[model samples]
Target: MAREIDQAHLLEYTGEFSFDHKLILEFIKTAKPDYDHTDPKTWPLITSAYLNKWLIKPYSGVLMLPPFIAYERSLVDLCVADREDGNVELVREDGVKTVRSRFHHHFPFIYNHNGHKRKFEYMHADHYTSWVFGVTGKVPATRTKGKDTPSASADPFDEILELIQDAQHAHKTDGATSLRAELESAHKDLDESKKRVVAAEAQQKLLDKELTHERRRAEGLVQSKKALKQDLQKAFRGEMEQHTITQKQLERVNRELADTNKLWREATNETIAAEARSKKLEKTLKDRDKDLQVSREQAATLQEQMVKIRNELKKGMEDGGQKRQADSNASSSQKKKVKIQQ
Candidate 1:
């Protein structure tokens, strides 16, 4: 019966849910025990750090975005079930779903639709961290004037049973008078809750301003960083140009040096060949002189033998004289040939 009643209420609420703001405030407190949740200014800083840590991006924008995809918002239908069984999920994830396909980006939708049929006019700030942590984005309002208040419509004993009965006739029984008193008290409490909501909304506006200022300061810092980078690149560009010119000059000088080395090697080889030829010619002249010395010795021996023969044949004077003359001519020719050989 309770489940049926909850399902009926769910039918009436075709859109999202809204939970107590204190739950989120409590979450902030648990997340950062150092910061004071009472201080409105700290919310933005905490939220930014939370966003940066979980989503890999700050609260302002994404880290890297693609150029082809337009920076525009598109509507999507998020469907999920409110579980009651033992199965639960607790993984910390932060990202938008639409861009997860091709870009690998996970930024979320900024504008939260409030009413059942969300139109453009109903754009309001979502009182959420955008981090999915097993809780629905919507739940019933439970805080009033910094105090938790019970709804007048719900019965103290049995919420589902009371909801099943009509609101006008639910209290018309033995506990009717007490129920009326409780109802009146609940109404008074509701007024205080409304006042608290108003105050919280005002405080949220101040927080938004602080967030805006912080974002502007961050943007200024980014701009200054970009300017510094440009200046550094400009400075390095001159050195790079000089380096390129010096490298080219060195290459040209190396080529010239290589050519000089090649010429020197060729000249040295030619000199070696000329020296080898000169050595061979000197060896040939030495061998020729040795041969000429042997021939001179032989010619001297032959002249001595002819003189002996002429003495022996003293009566044959004419023949001996003619032979002597021929021998003298041969000796003179031999001397001339030896001189030419030297």
Candidate 2:
């Protein structure tokens, strides 16, 4: 019977689920210690109730968003769920249906499987954090604020049940109560919730757009780096080719230098031999000139001796002729004296 009632309530709750800010705050404030942590079926009921009150019918303006404990600060968003143009659109996640609303990014949406038709808007701060975790998975740390609250010390669940009961009784049994006043309060709360949802949705859209632009810039930088590397490689290859050609030319010049050195050595030897022959010719000419000078002095001395002997011979002939003439004169005188005596 309890199971049947539970199922029946689940069906009804799913069909009428909507955001209700007051209900959410009340539930968190009044959660019992005995709220079954291990039961899967109970979780759906709890989640459906929570999402319905906060996301669909309650204040949809500002959502309280905190990071998932396991994921830590990594995945967190504050959302405003229901405003048009400023809302984050609902993108069907690959494996899951009814994820956060892509509309009004500031007010993130909550999905309850059992109450799939109703959408819930999260409060902009910690509220969105709780809502996201509740839908994706349960967060053990989160619970109602009531028993934890210092004010009314009582059984948490009973306290919440009594509060609901008293409110109902006040509306039904109390007479002469102004229905207009209560309706006005409800409308005011709903408007505030919607405004918060709009704000959160706007923030989420901005983040997505920024992330897309950053990715494109990174891709461009990578392409630029690749082009620079290719140019450097081409320049290095050209320099290597030039260096090789220069080295080959240097080797040829060295070979020509070696051949010129050998030719210089041969020419030096020939010059030394020519100088030796010239010195021998000079000595032979000096010896011939001294011999000719001695022969000329001897011929001049022999000619002077021959001229003195010819002069002495001529003087002897003149003396002999004078003696012969004296003898003739004497003979003539003697013959004349003999004739006169006779």
Candidate 3:
């Protein structure tokens, strides 16, 4: 099976960068930072600040930031679940309200965090995992109210939640970086592969055309063989007819010699003249046999040429078959790789 890289997974970092593992780790030490009383609240506050920078900006434009914020909100909701002990309390400037009712169940999946309306469901699961695991901390039940004592107290879920947040941010940032690099590499490979595919297609087309030509050539050979067979049959018939005519001529000559011998025997009694006539007939028969031998050699050469053509056609057919099979296998492998990616 062919391996295809997933570009999306390669760059995990995106959005507001809330889930950066490094940021989560650094955040754990501070937990919730103290508000500066000396600075005026209205002086100026950076609304777009993200511990994980990638988590903050959704895209290059204004359209990008909202989705990431939504994801971060979702993680917070998942993390802070309702405990049955009623120990949890929500404090405001007005006063402290203890969580008492079992009916509250859990915090809503959609809630406002840091004045931004964010939803946990919108956040990616990986982001949540990073936030939960990367940052190490404990969530204390109450905040100490004294200058000498630290205001923030460690709780069991604090560090874990922070880690989860950090991991997600780090994952996205690294993911974006890795994705950029990978996309570049994939693009290059894709271009090269496309070139190879084009060449393969061209070669396949040429093979197809050659195979068609070979088929036509094979058909022509078959026709030629049939014509040659007919020609040989005609030659054989002509040879037989000529042999019959020669035999008739030889018989006539013998009959004449017999008549002449009869006359000679009666006139002067001559046997030498009959012996010379018989030797001449034997020489004519030998000359006819030599002509037949030459004809047979010509036929044998024609048969050899026909056999060579047939062999060439057979070899061409086999090569074309193998090439088509290889193409089919390659196509199948490519399909399987695509399926795996899906």
Q: CA lDDT, every prediction?
A: 0.35, 0.36, 0.35
Q: Tell me which residue pairs clash in candidate 1.
A: 17-138, 17-139, 18-138, 18-139, 19-139, 95-106, 96-106, 96-107
Which of candidates 2 and 3 is the stronger one according to lDDT? 2
The prediction achieving the highest lDDT against the true structure is: 2
**For residues 1-342, could you state the per-residue lDDT of candidate 2 as single tens digits?**
011112223211222222243443334334432322222223223232344354433322222332111101111222222222323323222332222433322212232222232232222223333344434443324332211211223223223233334444544222213322433343444343344344334444444443343344345434554555556557556656777647676676456545444444433433343343334434433443444344344444433433433333333334445666788888899999999999
Worst 10 contiguous positions by lDDT, candidate 3? 37-46
List the candidates' TM-scores in order: 0.21, 0.22, 0.21
lDDT, candidate 1, residue 166?
34
Per-residue alpha-carbon lDDT of candidate 3 for residues 138-231, written as tens digits (9 for 90 to 100): 1212222211211334324323233334434544232334433443444444444443444334333433443344344445544554565566
Of 2 and 3, which scores higher on TM-score? 2
Cα error of candidate 2 at position 231, Å: 46
Better of 1 and 2 by lDDT: 2
What count of clashes does model 3 give? Answer: 50
**Model 1 TM-score relative to the real fold:** 0.21
lDDT of 2 at 252: 62
